[model samples]
Target: MQYVQRADRKIVGYEETEYDQNRRNSRDQGKKKFSRTMALILGVVLTLELMIMGAMLFHIDFHSADRIAMVFAFAVLYFGVVAGLTDK
Candidate 1:
């Protein structure tokens, strides 16, 4: 079977072989899986950040809270951007 696609205002037509289809599907699936994994990791990291912040609020050992918070914030921001791009 064949399909048509539009790119850069140009019309293109191509036929995908069985092997090509499987390869494409696997690559797409891998992106989805990686996005999910990143989401889970982001969630865990955020949770740790909250816990650490809460500990500092409760007057616990959080002398390095500033450094840790920055790390978690950047991690979440980076992963969030990656997830958003992959989902679309």
Candidate 2:
């Protein structure tokens, strides 16, 4: 057991066992991996969405409901993905 102090006051006494330290390190590593994976997936999705939108806009062929629907779907998906990733 070790005593933790602050400003000459003993806050508490707790033992930081090796097992606890190892568990904490593993959890941190997992979070890093998850964050990296999410960032990569989101980056690819966003890039593809932007490219498609740019092509459609430059062509000026958004005259059909199908095209508009597709754009709308992409917009919804983009927002949904962002929200989902950020909520974590």
Model 2 residue 16 lDDT? 88
Query: Candidate 1 residues 1-88, lDDT tens each?
Result: 5656677777676788899999989988865444666666766666677767766788756565587776787678666655664464
RMSD of model 1 against the true structure: 9.1
Q: Global lDDT of each model?
A: 0.68, 0.70
lDDT of 2 by residue, 1-88 (tens): 5677878785988888999899889988876434756765885678587757876787744454477676786677766666666665
> Residue 33, candidate 1: how far off, in angstroms?
7.1
Give the CA lDDT, 0 to 100, for residue 55 in model 1: 69
Question: What TM-score against the true fold does each predicted structure earn?
Answer: 0.30, 0.47
Candidate 2 wrongly placed segments (more than 4 Å): 1-12, 33-65
lDDT for model 1, please: 0.68
* Highest lDDT model number: 2
